[model samples]
Target chain A: MPRQRPPAIRIALCLAALAAGLLPWWNAREMAKSAFPGFEVTAPSAGESGEPAFFKKTVVNPFSPHKKSHSASLVRMEDGRMFAAWYAGSGECAPDVAVYLASTDAAGNWQAPRAIFNREKAMADLGRNVISVGNALLLADGNRLGLLFVTVAAGRWSGSSMNIAWSDDAGMTWSRAQNLTMNPLANLSALPRNPASPLAGGGWAVPVYEEFLGKFPEVLWLLPRGGGYDFAVSRVAGGVSVMQAALVPLSRTDAVCLMRDFRPAQFMSISSTADAGRTWTPPQATELPNKDSGICGARLPDGSILAAYNDRSTGKRENLRLAVSGDGGKTWKRVATLEEEPGFEFSYPSMVCDPDGTVRMLYSARQTQIVYVEFNTAWLKEQEVLQ
Target chain B: MSTLTVFLLVVWFFQRVLPVRGLLGLGVSTAAGAAFVFIPWLGFWIKSLAPNASIPMVGLLLAAILGRACNKSVFRPADWKAAWIFGAAASLMLYPSALGLGAFDTYSLGWPWLFHSVSIALFAGVGVASAVLLWLGNRFGYLLLLAGLGYLAGFQESTNFWDYVLDPLFGAVSLVALIAMAWRSRNPRPANPRGTTAP
Candidate 1:
C-alpha cells in the first residue's frame, strides 16, 4: 500500500493549490481597479451645437471600376485632413483585391481613390504567393500612420495572416509591407475592422478578430516599446462567436467594445475592459440589432457615443441607422437613418470625429461605391426630434 | 501536374530504382499523394470536408513514404506516441482559443518572448525524453531528432512552431490511436498456457 502524506502537509498542499487558482482572478481585479480608478458616466447636453452645424455627404470611390469596394476605415490626420481606406477588387477575397486610400481636402472635396497595396506587390515582398487581400484598416499612432490588412496565402480564409505597413508622412507614401510574426505557421487569420482606440498609456487598442476556424474578437494593444511598437493581445471573454469589434474609449482607462455577432442571434455583442484593455468581461448582447455586418462606433466631443449599424436583426442588409449614447453605450436612442432602402446593401460603417465636432462616417453604399457622411451633434439632435 | 504531385512522382521514381521488397507500396503511396494533389475530385472534396491540411502534414506523409522505401518505420510506436502527445496538446491549446472558449488566447503567445521560451523548453524536454527512451531501446528518439531538424530547417510553409509540430490530421490520428490503445488494454488477450501458443 502507498504511504499517505501527513494531514498537515496535505492541508498545506491543498492551500497552495487554492492560492494558485485564485492568483489570476486577484491580479485581474487589481489591474482593473488600478486602470480605472474613478469611473463615472457623463451625459451629453440636450440640443446644443457644441460646434458649427455641418452636414456633408459624398461618394468616396465614385469612379473605381472595381467590381467591389467595401470594408472602409476612416482616420483623421493631425493636419485636420481625413483619409479613408477600403479594399477594392473584382470581388471579395479575389487575388486582385487591393487596399485603396482616398483623402478629403480642406474644402471637403473627395479625391480619387488610389490602390496603395495589392497581392502582387505583397507576394513579391513576402516571397510567397498571396492568394487575396482584404480587411484594410487605417490606424493612427501619433505622427505615424499604420495600415493593417489580411493576406490569404493558401487561397482560404483559415490560411490568412496579418500584414502591416507604415506611412510617416500621412497616407502619401507607405513603407514596404512586412508580415506580422504572430505565429510560427502564421495561420492565425485576423483582420482589423476598426480604427485604433488611444490607450491611457503610450499605445493604441486596435480591435481585430479571427475569421477562420474560429470567429471571435481580441484587442491588439500596440504599446510603444524600445523605439517602436510591440503588440500585446487581450482576448475578450465569453461569447461563442463574435467579430469586427468597434472600440469606444469611455474614460482614460475604461473602454467598451461593440462586436458583430456571427452566431444565430443576430444581435450586437458588448464587452467592457476597465484596465486599459488588459482584461475584459465576457461579452453579452446589446439591445441594438445587427445583421451580421460591420458596425462603427466613435466618441463625440460632447461625451456622447455615436454608433452606426444595420437596424434590423434578420433580413436584407438595409436600414443603416445612427444612434447616440449618453451613458457610455449602455443604451442608445436612434437619431438618424443613414440608409433605409429595402433592397440596397449599405454596411461596414467607419466613423471618426473631427476637431470641429464633425462626425465623419464612411460606409459602403453598395459593393460598388464608398459613401461618406459628415454631421454634427446638433444635426443628430434635430434628427432625433424628427424621429 | 501540380508542384506537389510532381514532387511526389519524383520521389516515387527514385524509390522504385532502389532494391526494395515492396515496390508496390511506393507506387501506392505515390498514387495516394498524387490523388490528393492532382485529382480535383478527391482533393477538393477532402479540402471542403476537412480543410485543415498544413505543410507539416505533407512532410509527415513524405517521411512515411521514404521510411517504407527504406524498409524502416519512420515513426515507431514511441514516435507515434510523441506525435500523439504533440497533436493532442496543440489541439487543446489551439481549438478552444480558436472557438472563443477561454480568456487566455494561446495564439497571442505566438509572437511574444513567452512563445520562444516555451518552444525552446519543449524542444529540450523532447530531446531529453527521447534520449531516455533511446537508452531504454526505443527508436522514437531518432524520429524526434529528425522532426527537430525539419523544424529548424523551416520545411513547413508556415513559420509557426505549432504548425511544424501538429495539425488536424495528426490530432485525429492520435485520438484514434489513444482510444484503440485504451480498448486493447481493457481486453488484453489471455497468456499462452505453458508455452503452447499457436504457430
Candidate 2:
C-alpha cells in the first residue's frame, strides 16, 4: 500500500478547508442584507415667493492664496448645523496637502478652517507612506458625520484609495481612518468627489470613481456598522472616459448618475439605474458641456434637477454655472452663472439642499479658497425668470 | 496594512533587498521585526512597495523563503509548479477584464450581492477546489485556506477575496516562471561531455 499522510494532518487540512469554504459564504450572507434599495429625495416643503429671499456667497477659507484649495463638499446635520470640507496644501499633488473642515454656526457664520487629515495621519492610520491627500467628501448620517477622502501612497491620483472617518459630535472629533478596499489590483484608484445620497434602508449611496488604467464611475454602498460602517463598491458604469459621478435620486428605486467626461469636447455623461444600484444603463452624453471638470447635482424642492459645473464648452474652468433640468437630467437650461471670470478658475462645485428649503453650494475659487453660496427656491426661480 | 503584512514587508526587504543571506529563518524574521520597529526609513521603503503587493502573496513568498531557510520546507518543485499554474491562470482570467479590456468585468464577481449568479458560482468553485486540494494534501491547499481565512477575518483593507489570493506581482512572477520552465523543458542539456561519449 502507498504511504499515507498522518490522520491528524488530514483532519486538520479538512477542517481548514471547511473553514476556508464556510467563512466567505457567511460573510457574503451578512453582506447580502446590506441593500441599496435606491435613494429618495428628501426636500423640505416648498412654498416660497419669487422675491429672492436670501442669496449670499462667501469664501470658506480666505488668505493663503499661495496654497492650493479644491474639491469642497457640504453636509447639513440633523440639528441644522452645516459643515464644509476641502483639501488644501502647496499644490494639487504636493505631499503637504491636508483635508480641512469648517463648520457654520446657527447664524450662518463660517468658522476658520482646521486640518482634519493629512499625510502623516494617513501614514499612521494606514501603516503606509502616503504621498498626498486630495478630495474631501462630507456626508451626514443623521447626527453623526462621515468624511470620505482620497489618499495617494504611490504614483498619481490613480494610485489613490478612499479612507473614511466618522465624527459623532459633529466635526470636532473623529474616529481613526479606515481604508476602503476598492480595487483588487493593489487596492488602488478609488476617489470620492460629490456628496452621498441617503439610501432607503439605512445607508448612504456614495458616488466614487476609479482612475487606474481607466476612468469610470462607481457607487460605494455604505451600511451602518458599529461606530463606522461596512462598505461595498458597485460600478455605476464602466468606461475609460467618464468619472466623478454625482448621483441624484429620482425615486425610491431609481437614480441617475451624472459623470465628468474625460474625452475632449464631450458633454457630461449620464447613466440611470432602475433597480437601485445593482445594474445601470450604458452611459451616454448629456446636453451640458464638460471640460473634464468635477460636477455636482441635487434634486430641487420644485421637482427639478439642479446641476452645477463649468459652463465653458471646450476650454478652461473659468466660468461656473447652475443649470436646472425639468424632465430629469435629459435637458438643462442655465439659470444662474455663479462665477464668470475670463481667466480665473472657478470649478469643482458641490451642492446640497438643506432641510429648511435652503440651497447651499461650495466650489473652489481661483484654487486659492473655497467659496460658499446659499440661496432659496425663490432666488432660483428669480434667476430662471431673468434667464 | 495588517500587522502581518508590515512584518512580511520588512522580511521581504531583508530577503530580497539586503546583502545578508547567511541567517536562519528565525534570525531573519527577528531582525526584520527589529528593523521595522527601530528604523523609520526602512518602514517607509517597505510600505512604498505596498501598491504592488497583497498580504497573502507576501505571506506565501515569506513562507517559502522561511521554509527553505529553516530546512523544513513544505513545498516541492511540483508544488511550486502548481502554484505558478494557479497564479498564471488566475491572472489571465482577471487582469484583462479588470483593466477594462472587455464589456463584462471579471472583477465585479468579487463583490457581494452585485452579480448574484457569478458570485454564487465563484463561491461554489472555491469550495469544491478547497475540498479537492485538501484531499490530495497539496501545500497550495493551505495557502488557499489562509487566503480565505484572512479575507474572512478582514486582515487587510481589501474586501475582494481575490485581493487576498493574488496580486499583479505574483501573477507576473508566475508567468515568467512558467515561461522559463517551458523553455528549459524544450532545450534540455546533454548528459555527456563535449569530448567524451557515454559509457
Candidate 3:
C-alpha cells in the first residue's frame, strides 16, 4: 500500500490546482472590466421636430485615376483632422492596385487623394514580388497612425498576408512595412475594415475575418508592445460562415459583432463577446437585412449603437440605410435612408461620432468615389418623424 | 522555370550521380528534371491535382543511393511503422481542429511563442530519435534529418510547418498502409494445415 501524504501537503496541492483554475478567470474578468465600461443608454425623446441639417462631400474622383476603387476606411487624427484611405487600380487584386489617402482641413474641405502605398513599393520593401495590394485600413493610436493592408504573395488571395506601416507625422510620411505574422501559413485573409475601438486597458480591438478555405471571423487585439503594436488574436466562434465583422461594445466587458454572412442568409449575423473580444458566442441571424456586403458601426455619445448598411436582401446595391439601437443592439429601428437610387452601388460604410455629437459617415458611392456625410441625433430624429 | 524547381532538379541530379556512378543515372535524372521544368502543363496539372504534392526528392534520393550501396531496402519495417505513427498522429491532431470541430484552435499555435517552442521541441525530439535509429544502422534517420533541414531552409514555397511535415497525399498513403497492416495482422493466412501434404 502507498503511504498517505500529510494534510498540509494535500492542502497545498489542492490550493495550487484551485489557484491555477481561478487565476485565468479572475484575470479575464478584470481585463474585460478595464477594457469595456458599461454605459447608460438614453432613449430618444418623442415628437421632437426641427429642420435637420448635414454636410456631404466627395473625397476622391474614381474616373481619373483608377477604374475600380472600394474598401474605404476613415480615422480622426489627434489634431482634430479627419483622414481616409482606400485602394484603387484597374480592378480589385490587380498588380497596379495601390492604397490612396485623403485628409480634410479644419474648414472641412476635402483634399485631393494621393497614392500612399503601391505594389512596387511593397515589393521593394519586402524584397519579394508582391502580386497585389489592397484593403487599406487607417488606425489612429495616440500620436501615431497605423496603416494595415493585405499583400498577395503567390498571385492568389489564398496566399495573402498582412503588412503594417506607421506614420508618426499624421499621414505625411510612412515607415517601411513590417510583416504581421499571425498564421503559420501566411494566409491571414482577414483585413480590418473599420477603425479600431479603444479599450480602457491601453489597447484596441479590431475586427478581422478569414476566407481562405472557410470563413472564420476573429477579433485582433492590438496592444502597445515596446515602441509598436502587437496583436493577440481570438476566434469568433460562430458556426455560421461570417466575415467582415463590425464590433459594438455594450459594456465594459461585453460587446456585440454584426457580421457579413457569405452564405445566402440574407441577414446580418450577430455574435457577442463578454470578455472584451477574447472569445465570442456562436453567431446567429439578426433582423437587419444584408446583401453580402461590408457594414460598419460606432457607439454614439448617448450610448446608442448606430449601424450603416445596404438594407435589402435581393436587390441592386441601392438604398443604404442607418439603424439605431438603444437596447445595446437587442432591437434596432431603421432611422434614416442615406442613399436610395436604382442602378447604383453604395456599400462599405464606416462611421465615427465626433466630440460635438456629430456623426461622420464615409462610404463608397457606386465604386466611383468616397462619400462623406455628417449628421447628428436631431437629423436622425427628424428623419424618423418623416417616416 | 521557377528558381525552386531548378534548384530541386540540380540537387536530384547531384544525388543520382553519387550512387549510379555513371552517365546513365545522370542522364535519367536530367531527363526527369527537364520534364518537370520545361513542361508547363505538367507543372500546372500536378498543382491542380495534388496542391501540396511535390515529391520528397532528397529523401527518395538518399534512400535510393543507400539501398544501392548496401544491397538492401533503406526503409525497414520499424521505419515504416514510425512513418505511420507520425502520419496518423498528425492527421488526428490537425484535420479535426482545422475543420473547427474541436474546442481548441490548434492553428493559433502558429503564433510566435508557442510556435517557436513547439518547433524547437519537435526538432530536439526528432534529433534524438534519428540518432538512435542511425546507431541501429537505419538509413531512415538520414531521411528525417534531411526533412528537418529542408524545413529550416524553407525549401518549399509554404511557410507552414505542417506543410513541411506532411501533406494530404502523405497522410492518405500512411492511413491506407496502417489499415492494410491492421487487416493482415488480424486475419493472418492460415498456415498449411496439412504440413507437407499439399502438391
Candidate 4:
C-alpha cells in the first residue's frame, strides 16, 4: 500500500488554511467600518435626461461598418472622465476588428465612438499579432495614463500578451504603445496597490486573472517589475476568474479588492492582500449571487469600495446592482439596482467613484446597447444592501 | 544574426515558446550534441544538410516541436489526446478568410518564401499532426516527427500559437483529468485469483 501521509501533517495544513482564511475577514470588517465611513446614491440621475439609467439592449457592434462587438473594459480618467473601451468588429477575432473607446463627462453623457488601437499597426511592428487594450488608468505619476491588455500576434486569443499605451493630458494626447509581457491570454485586468506593494516596494500593481495551464485564477504583478507574479502564503479573498479586482487602501500591508469569483451562484468574491498583492486571502462568498455577468469595482470618497455587477444568477445583466463595502470588503450591502425590470439584461457593470465621492457606472444589455448610471454615495446608503 | 545565433535562438525558441512544451527540442539538441560527442551524427548532418537544410528543417522542426508540445503537456498529459484532436482541428480550421479558400497566407507567399512555406506548413501540419497523433496514437511514429513539425506553428510571426500553449479553460479541464489519472494510477485494481469484480 502507498504510505499514508502523516495525520499530523494533514491536520497542520488544514488548520493553517483555516486560520489564513479567517484572519482576513476579522481584519477586513474592522477596516471596512473605518474606511467606508458610509455611502448613498444620487436622486436625479443622468437617465432622467430622456434616457433611463439602463439600456438593456446593447448591440454587439453598435458602430461597426458591419456590426459585431465583444470584450470591454471601463476606466475613469483622473480628470473625472468615464471611458468604456471595447473590441468592435465583425467578430471577436476578426481582422477588420479594432479597439474602440467611448467616454462620458462627470455628468454621465457618453461621447461618440472612436478607435484608439488597431492590429494593423500592432502587427506591422510586433509581427502579425492582434492587440486589445483593457483597464486604462490615469496615474498621478507624470499624470501618465497606463493601458493594460492582451495581444495575440501569432495566432488567436490564446496567443494573447499584455500590452500598454498611455496619454499624458488625460485621454486627449496618447503615447507610443509598449509590450508589457510575452505570456498570452492574460485577462480581466485591474491595477490595485496600497502603500507597500512589492513593485512599488509597496505601491500599485496591475492584478489580472490568468487561467492558462493552471486551474484556479491568480492575479499577477504588472509594475515595479515587468515579470511574473510574486507568491506567498496568503491569496486574494477568493478563488475566481474574470475577477473584477478593485483596490482599496486601509493601511500598510492591508487593502481590499471587490472581486467576483466566476461561480454562477456565488456572486460576490472579495480578496485581500496583506503583503501587497503578492499574496491574498482566499475569497469569501457574499449574499450577492453573480448573474454570470462580469463586474467592475472602484473606490469612493468616504473610503467605501463600490462594486457593480449583475445581481442575479440567471437572465441578463438586468440586475446590475451597486453595493458598498463598509468593512473593507468583508461584507457588502446593496445600494440600488442601476437597472430595473423591462430593463433587465443590463450587465457587464463598470463603475468609478469620483473624487467628490459620487458614484458612476457603465453597462450594456442584450449585448446590443450601452448605458450609464449616475448616483451619489448618500442616495445609495438609503437603499437596501442585498444581504 | 549569425548561423550559430539562429541555431541557438531555435533552441531557446523551442524551449520557451510552446504552451504544451516538452523538452523534446532540448532533448534532441542534447542528443545531437551527444552524436557529435560520440556517434558523429551532428557533424555528419552538418556536412550533409548544411545551409540549405537550415531553412526547411527549421520550419519542419517548428511544426514538429509545436506538434509534440501540443501532444500532452499542452493540455494535461492525460487529455493530451483531446488537445491533439483540437490542435489538428484548429490547423485544418483554414476557412474563407483574407486568402479565399486556400490554407496558409497568400500574403506572405507574395512576400518571402522562407516566411510563406514555413508559416503554412507549420500551421497546417500542427493541426494535422496533433489530430493524427491523438486519433492514431504513438503507433505510426508520428510523435517521432513532432519536434520536426512544431517549428511550423510560428512560421508566420503573427500566428497565434498560444492557443496550443495556454488555451483557455482547457487547462482546468486538463487539470481535472490529470488528477483523475493520477488517482487512478495510484489506486490500481487489485488482482483476484477469483477474477472479475464490479467497476
Best-fitting candidate, scored by DockQ: 2
Candidate 4 CAPRI assessment class: incorrect
The regions of model 4 sitting more than 4 angstroms off are A1-83, A103-110, A131-142, A153-156, A169-174, A182-203, A215-244, A313-316, A342-344, A382-387, B1-199
lDDT by residue (tens digit), candidate 2, A1-387: 123479887777777777675567656665575566667666434546444567999988876544789889999887878899999999886998999999988897898889999899888886777899998899888888889998887888987888888888877788888877776676778888988998876789899888889778888888766755667777777669888999988777777898899787568888888888778888889889888888998887766778998866625698888898888788889898888887789989999875455789999888888999998877877887887
Which ten residues in a row are the worst by lDDT in model 1 chain A? A32-41
Candidate 1 runs further than 4 Å off: A1-50, A106-108, A154-159, A169-173, A181-188, A237-240, A313-315, B1-80, B110-173, B176-199
Residue-wise C-alpha lDDT for candidate 4, range B11-51, written one tens digit per residue: 54545554424566566653443444244333322221121
Q: Candidate 3: where are CA atoms >4 Å away?
A: A1-55, A154-156, A184-188, A238-240, B1-80, B99-104, B112-199
Candidate 1 lDDT over residue span A1-387, tens digit each? 123457675444444333322232332332332332222323333435566666788899878899999999888776667788999999878988999999878886888888888888877665545778888888776667888888777656666777788999867798887766443233457678887776555557778877665577877656565677655455775345788888887776678888888777777878887775657877788888886888989877777778889887435578789888888788888888888877789989988765445788889987788999988887887789989
TM-score of chain A of 3: 0.84
**DockQ score of each predicted structure, in the order shown:** 0.13, 0.43, 0.06, 0.03
Per-residue lDDT over B143-181 for candidate 2, one digit per residue giving the tens place of the 0 to 100 score = 777777776777665667677677887788789999999
lDDT of 3 at A176: 91
Evaluate chain B of model 4: give its TM-score: 0.24
lDDT of 4 by residue, A38-102 (tens): 11222222322222232222332344453544445555654656566665666655666666667
Give me candidate 3's TM-score against the actual structure. Answer: 0.71
Look at candidate 1 and tell me the lDDT of residue A127: 51
lDDT of 1 by residue, B5-100 (tens): 344645555555555446566766566556555654444333222333444345555666667677776656665665566556666766566556
Worst 10 residues of 4 chain A by lDDT: A188-197
Rank ordering of all candidates by DockQ, starting from the highest:
2, 1, 3, 4
Candidate lDDT (C-alpha), each: 0.67, 0.77, 0.64, 0.44
Candidate that beats the other on TM-score, 1 or 4, i.e. the better one: 1
Q: Alpha carbon lDDT of residue A302, candidate 4?
A: 58
